[model samples]
Target: MRIALIGRPNCGKSTLFNQVAGYKAETGNFHGTTVTYTESKVRVLGEVVDLVDLPGTYVLGGSNPAEKVSHDYLGDHPVDVIINVIDATFLAQSLELTLELLRLDKPVLLAMNMMDEVARLGIKLDGPALEKELGVRIVPVVASKGRGIKALFLEAKRAAEQGILQPRFDDFQDDPYSRHKAALQLSQRFAVQGQRTLSWRDRLDDIFLHPAYGYVALAGVLLLFFQAVYGVGQLIEPPLLALFDSLITNLNTYIDTGNLLGVLLNGVLQGVMAGFAIVLPYLFPFLLGLGFLEDVGYLPRIAFLMDSLMHRIGLHGKAIVPFILGYGCNVPAIMSTRTLEDSRERFIAAALSTLVPCAARLVVVFGLVAFYLGPLYAFGLYLLNLFIIALTGRILTRLLPENTPGMILEMPPYRIPTLRAVANKAWFRIREFIVEAWPTLIFGSAALGLLVFFDIAKYFNWMVRPITWLLDLPAEVGVPLIFGVLRKELSLIMLGQALGNNDYSAVLSNAQLFTFTVFVVFFVPCVATLVMLKRELGSRQMVWVTLITIIIAMGAGLAARIFGLLL
Candidate 1:
């Protein structure tokens, strides 16, 4: 049997999907989390069942990807049962979608999810009456907490067996008399309150969705997120270092060999180990925290907040999520801009995303600046990334023709996200990172290993001597820069190895580290990003971005060095 989960945005549908399907898929409180449908299988009630989690849509009729996908799925490949998940606290609004689904004549089951929130808000639902009126089983559930799922599953099986999954349609339009008559009839049977009460949530929505405070709250929240990433990321680093130390010692003892071969092995192991210990732990945990915030329904508020700014910059506010995700890695963020409706917007967003300093790059800035220039300089480098993105967006907006983007976004009230769903989303994204980035990381490490093993670093150091003279950086720094093109974070690790110590200040002055960070920040994105740029924007744009980035990075390096001379 095939069971389909459907709902409007942020109705706990994805969370419930994870719970029942026993798999990880992306679940964000943002509107476009599941742009594509995801399928998984699970056995319930002694029967094998396929479950599909469809994209969230406000209505069944729309041109947006999610809406079209949902409509297409229902019309062409109809499911045996339709689980219409709804936010219990906002029954009136969510029921609108449920009403549309009922028209499809499937075996519709109303899963009133987030029931705990409903009760917390002192709202009551007459489930039996609702079931009778809708002519289907209505199950109240707290899907995140695993409440009422067994009973819901049993009802779904019975509905499938009885073949009562036929859709019911009600059209109340134009004629007020007919509309009143239908509504009254349904009300009598359903026992629904004539109108929802004016509650604190309503007042809160008025404020949060307000034009001014909403955006202010958005900026404030974003600032907090960045600070948390920096602070919490630091707090977690020492433990990760200890773990890497243990792995390295154990591996060395087990692989007891001698001479140059052992050195090669150690180099590969060290590079791979550093990639996992330093980069992956920091990147994954930070992403998980961001994912949790997104799952809890905060990102759209950010979109809404940045809508004006995004519009001014020739893009939509919805582009911000992908841009922020770019801080983790530009490749996925660039790919994610596919969610944007406008091709022009996607291009601009993609271009800007690559410029944002991803965590891999951030690791470079933090390592160099904190060690040589102090914590303030390290933090400034981060702010500089945001500044550059904003400045670039503004310039790009002016360069392009004006296009007004539409916003038909719904802001779901915040709810405590299910741990299962959050974990699933984090793991899913992390898995994507591993698949897309790990190979590049391993290869970059191996390539650096080969260069070091074969003494190619000496040649590269000589080759970069002229550039180093201009930039006032030591020739040795070129070794890191060459490998940096392969992976940004690896440059820092390579710098540590080349310097023969974690403290780079002993080798290069503070000004040199500053120039290096600026150059690395503006330099070409990692190989993964370059490939994605080629894939998404074609070879022409990729080539142009590369040329422009190299010019800017070198120019910035020269200027920083020149300014230091003046000082």
Candidate 2:
């Protein structure tokens, strides 16, 4: 049997799907978060069934990419049951979608989610009456808290097995506006407005969504968020780095350093150290904070705040999530572009979002700038990066003009994030690095080590020397720049190795450090990100994006070099 979860944007449908589907789909507090459907297999009531989580849509005939995908999937595929999830607080607004779902004549089960929020708002819902009136089964649920999930799935199983097609709304009009009117009527009949009072949601929204204060709050929240992640990474990185350094020392004591074999093994160890001791320490904490921001519904508010600024670049608020996600990692940032309706916007968003220094690149910025200069300098570098991105975006838009409409985003009420959901999400993203990228790091390091032993590594450095020479840095820095594309942090790790010292300040002047770090920040994305780009935007576009980034990096590096000399 095939069971599908369907609902309007921000109705907790994806949340409900996660309760059973094990975080298989991305859930956000905004509409169009899940632009594509995800399918997973599960056993329901002693029978195995296919459960599909679809992108949220208000009407089956909607024109947006997410809505069209949902509509097309449901129409083309065979679904045994449709689980229509609704936000209990907004029964009137939600029923518009629910009413439309009934017209499909499928075995429909209403999963009224966020019941806890409904009760807190002093709203009264006659679930039985609505269920009876619509001639369908309804299950009241608080999906975030895992309340009523088991019963909801069990009822869904029965509905599918029994082939209970929901009663059709023959009197309702064929167009979406008519169903919306009928939905409001149904909400009035079954949902009583029981002396509704302002809840914490209202109070928080007033502060969080305020024009001036909201921007201040956003800055404060993001600053604190990054500070905490950096603190965690700082606490953990040194000890691990020392341990790995000692191991390398021990390895050197047993093997002759002058030999080719020793070079290869040391290179392999450096790769291992780079991934575990350096990258993972910072990455995990950053992902957790990002997950918190996403799950707690702050991301859309950010999109809201940044909408006008985004409009300056030919895109709107919807494009900002990818930029925000880019901070965690570039792969997902590129993946998130599918939510945009225009192909032109997707390509533009994907290209520009890459300029947001990911945590991997953050490794370089923090190591070189924050540690050597100061956090203030690092912050300024970030501002400079954004400025460059804006400049690049304007250029891209002139090349590809946009006719798409502005963002139509929904604000999901903030909910306390469940630890399980947050951890699961962080791990889900981190696993991509550990499983796919980590081994590549290890091998790439060993390969570099092999090249050094055979005396071919210098030629590689010679090839990249033009960039470093142009920026007035040591020719040896060329090696790290070339290898940095494999895994971003490799640039830092290999920088220490190339200079024959781990202390960056002792080996390099301040201007060189600033210029080199700036170059890394804007350079071509790492191989993992490149693969993701190819998968998302096709091979030809991937090459196009890469070439564009190289041009941007070179221009930015020259500018930073000139500026650093003045500083």
Q: After superposition, how far is residue 95 of candidate 1 from its true place, in Å?
A: 3.8
Off by over 4 Å in 1: 73-78, 103-106, 165-167, 170-224, 236-260, 418-440, 457-487, 498-502, 530-567
- Superposition TM-score, candidate 1 onto the true structure: 0.82
Give the candidate number with the greatest lDDT.
2
lDDT of 1: 0.73
lDDT scores for all predictions? 0.73, 0.85
Residue-by-residue lDDT tens digits, candidate 2, 330-436: 88789888878888898999999888999889988877887788777888899999999999888888988778677887778788888988898888888878887
lDDT of 1 by residue, 1-567 (tens): 888888877777777877777655566777777766888888887888888888877677756555678888878785899888887766666666766666565788888898887666655568776776667788989888889888888888787778764435465543435444554555444433444556675676566667888767666766676666666656766577678778877887876534566656766776776666666656766677777787667777777777877776678778887887787678768877767777677778888888888878877776676545766776776776667667777877787775656765667667566676666766776677577556666666556556766778779989878777778877777888877887787788777666655447877777888888888988888888899899878999888778767776777778677755653
Q: Report the Cα lDDT for residue 255, model 2.
A: 79
- Rate residue 217 of model 2 by lDDT: 95
> TM-score per candidate, in order?
0.82, 0.94
Candidate 2 TM-score versus the reference: 0.94
Clash tally, candidates in order: 4, 0
Error of 2 at 299 (Å): 1.9
